[model samples]
Target chain A: MNELHIPTMAQMAAEGKAPEILFWVGCAGSFDERAQKITRSICKILQHVGLSYAVLGTEESCTGDPAKRAGNEFLFQMQALTNIEVLNAYAVKKIVTGCPHCFNTLKNEYPQLGGNYEVIHHTELIQQLIDEGKLKTEDNESFKGKRITYHDACYLGRGNNVYEAPRNALQVLDAELVEMKRCRSNGLCCGAGGAQMFKEAEPGKKEINIERIEDAIEAKAQIVASACPFCMTMLRDGVKIKEKEQEIQVLDIAEITARANGL
Target chain B: MIAQLVFLIILAAAVFLFSKNTGKIRRNILLGKDADRSDQPALRWKTMAKVALGQSKMGKRPVAAIMHLFIYVGFVIINIEVLEITIDGLFGSHRVFSRPLGSLYGLLIGGFEILALLVLVSCVVFLSRRNLLKLKRFQGPEMKEWPRSDANYILFIEILLMTAFLTMNAADYKLQALHFGHYIKAGSFPVSALIAPLLPSNASSLVMIERGCWWFHIIGILAFLNYLPYSKHFHILLAFPNTYYSKLSPKGQFSNMASVTNEVKAMVDPSFVPAATEPGRFGAKDATDLTWKNLMDAYTCTECGRCTSVCPANNTGKLLSPRKIMMDTRDRITEIGNNLDKQGKDFQDNKTLLDDYISREELWACTTCNACTEACPVNIDPLNIITEMRRFIVMEESQAPPSLNNMFSNVENNGAPWKYSNADRMNWAESD
Candidate 1:
């Protein structure tokens, strides 16, 4: 296993087109079409508001979290070093990844491999873009009377503390935002963390996602919004399994942002 | 003056009983040998500072950590009160303040008694949290053979202590009424004021009650001191240092493997034959397999069940209870020590007890997720023992779960746990 050594946000921001931000479409976001579409929509909004940005598709890599949690520390280190080297080569900085796992690993775990970077999750960047008047919600009235709920992804909310950005982004659209009983630091794990997303849980009493989606239903939310691509996928799956897909919608925070933008 | 002599006698008796019981506990409960000279002192002192003073292990949860800090400080402060009580019992006069800065001393003593009460109440809350409220992670793992005696002993000791405390105050209050003809100035403890109304109006009755309660209190202390080594209260003394001396390594860091190359090299040489001596065991197979510090963790378990409650493996209906792992190790150590202490060289006959103490199935069920290690307020590293057991099984017996063996072989052969070809590994990198 080779190391993934990537550049920091400060370094990347200094080089290339010196784009206002580098949107890092992680492995999950690249593979998942819905997430890809939402990211594209967010990018379209960023471009529309004249915010200079470069999408660093090549700078992306598995955050090596799955490997580390699996006790393959050497593999994770190799992946981290390799990612660092690629990012360094591209002179990429000010990273914005849609995946909380990638964002958390790049910001928190990479320092152990000697890669320090100012990595922001996509919601923070999108909300920042909106706050700066670079993105707008033209159809804010669409969610005027509709009640929505925000599901705090463990990695994004508790693992890193990106709670405010996603909620703020949704609230900016004037939607009725309700919080599930367990939100923020005490937010329940979506059972998708620690690369449990890739592996099947060994026949537990309940699927972790069902527990979380049930909480959303308890909140009486018409839609359950999440920031991480994995959370979106799990919640969507939970909605299907619980036979509530017709009554409830699972959406990525970016999709909500896109809808608000009338894109 | 007679009372002063009695107090001195009680103090001496307490010291004797406490020292005796603690010695027994060190020998039996933890099988704690006088630490080896090779033991790290600098590490121990550093650990004491961080764990005893800093509450480092309790840092995972703030409420629990802060509560522990109060208890620790309260324990230290109340020691002065214990000495004061001993002196008062020996002296004709209850002159704990009969020294320099006596008023200030009394105030400090009073403050600490109140704090001690608070700490005691909080401990009760913590206990309730484990047994009743069912805080998600505080319930200890269910043991196949929990020392049923230990639970009974713990309940008995706590009740005895609380009773002794209340009785001691009652004695003091009655004696004060007898001497002063009304009420003695209630010391710093506000609860002691309750003694004023409860005192018998008849002087002789009050005196008899005081004498009886005084003796009962002293005897309770002695019995508790003697019982310390045999019961779970052993942690009451050991928790401070054990929590501090915890492993500095990350939760994932296992006991380092023995230098394998040296042995393998000699084994491969045509003229060489390996010695029949035990192969360098990577993990613990029995009590002797544990390091002294690992043994220390056994003595330090309060049996509060905090580790078992939070364990993902246990909650998922697995056999791996982190609490029981420590208890099993502790019990096995005690059993081995008791055997060795009584039978000396003939202790090898008792090896059968080891197999029954911990099952290989329970040992293998741990996911090493660190939730147990994380939730332990005392910072007992239960995962280390699990990993150690795994290491021994894999290295010594060449035994492993079938899938794990396949995974290990795949990694050695293909540089990945999966059997996928290297071409697939490069696909993620090569793809646009």
Candidate 2:
């Protein structure tokens, strides 16, 4: 592991200070190996822009999205209430997360349980940063006209309708943004939602992730860009299944954006 | 006078049967738990107008939509003639409305004849589409014996009723031409006029044919009215109210469980303790536990298979079929109603909607994609029922799948879905 001095919200609070936003390190971002890279890329971008943000560190827990979606309401409530209590104690007002699931639960579901916060997905935050001219992209030809296709994560795209932010963030890279046939509201799920990531899929002709990957391939995208870690995992697995892992790269919007900015 | 008295008795019997069946259906729907969807009268009315009356969502598939609209409009407008039939049957009058309305009655009857002809054509096309064309959505496992037969039965009844109507008008026309008893020039029947010449010319035979056709037409309409309560065709009556009470919130919004929320709130708040009631089951395990809207949705389903056709899980070869969900719910409610009828209101059967009707595998197969809800013309929310059932299995029985069990434990102990302690949560932030 590379040394990265990430501040904690507790440290900031103890110092009688507050950052502009709280970076919610969702479970996947916190512990999953591949997802950790995306988390680091987001951190790199935040550091490069000098945007003040702090993690909840050990204070962060699962948003209980998986538990709730899996029908474990009691578990979901327990986890959610614990997090809500902490968030309320810190008087946290704004949250930015790399995972669409966390983004959805924190923004939409949490408010119902009195954990109201201005929650934003990392793509949206990245787009905002680019829009404000705080983050500048390198004018390099490395990915200037590369054919990139964006997969819409269900929780982000259909669940919350944040279709444009990821695209806008991708557009900042000056890459050709190709759309699969089923894009936006009509987009198919990568199949790892509603706690599907944890369980085996019921019998089917084909895995949904493979079907979605086929769409990405059909679009002839050189790079498959995603905004959610679960989508990144599913799409990468799909690319591997096609045995084109060497030819096609599956990357997060943060990774591509960080690379584009030479962060 | 004897004929008039007989007609009155038949009419009363039909009305009583129709009302009794409708009342039973209404009571079964009310057996579901109360949910206050009565807010926003204006929005509800607008939804009813757009979805039920305007058939806006049906427009997603234009061919079916146009055909459906024709039948729907015809069904509503043609029923006006029933008023004339009812009055005539009771008072032994002929051309009663024609005498009062004059030329307007001629135009009205002509318009009805044209609409009736259109309805007949639409019904035939729909029948052929279901039977001959064999649309994939219409022939799935969910549409087995009774559903298929029920569809065919409605179409057959519609054809017979329309034929009787045209034949009645044709025979009436022939009677007038032959100067039969009480037969006078009254209303126009442009479509039936072509048939008048083909009928028997004898005055007494023409009177018998006319009276026979009239009686069949009126009696068929009454029988159709009663049969609707037992058929998916009940959508013809319930669609309006079902659409009116549809969930007006954003499609993505899942209603939070209020009881669970209150309990969680009490835990979070130091000053509060949720009052103890006998700990209620967290979600629906039986038909009665579901909200009344869910039962109303079941009754209002047209079984058009639009929802099943678009369902991701069903299309992907999973066991989840939204149409089947609605049908099973309706079947369970009907079963409960029958049990109550036999055992007098306090009847308890060991059967439950969860295991007996809807299987756990079926509920688990749903992706919560909302495709079914969006595709449904009548706005049925199959996802809500699936989620509720899944909740019952998880919260009450602790019977979630093994993977879900792992996730629940992780969330409970580690505050996340992964098997890692919170102390290690920030390790990724420090990793290169």
- Which one wins on lDDT? 2
Q: Where is the poorest 10-residue window by lDDT in model 2 chain B? A: B271-280
Global Cα RMSD, each model:
8.0, 3.4
iRMSD, per candidate, in listed order = 6.8, 1.5
Candidate 1: tens digits of C-alpha lDDT, residues B1-432: 676676677778778878875676565634432233235677767777766566666675678777666766766776676666666666654545536555675577467556656666666766665457766553334532345445545554544555456555655655664575434555544555565476666767766665676566556666666777776677777877776577654343333232332344354455755545444454567866766777888888877676776554465565668888888887778777777768894658546323577776666555454556656666788776766665566666666656655655554444344464433432332222
TM-score of 2: 0.89
Model 2 interface CAPRI class:
medium
Computed on C-alpha atoms, the DockQ of candidate 1 is: 0.08
Per-residue C-alpha lDDT of model 2 across residues B224-295, encoded as one tens digit per residue: 888999999999889999999999865556677778877777766768877654456888899988888999
Model 1 Cα lDDT, one tens digit per residue, A45-158: 555666566655433556555544443444455566667776766665567787777777777766554566678887888788878887778888667767799887666764
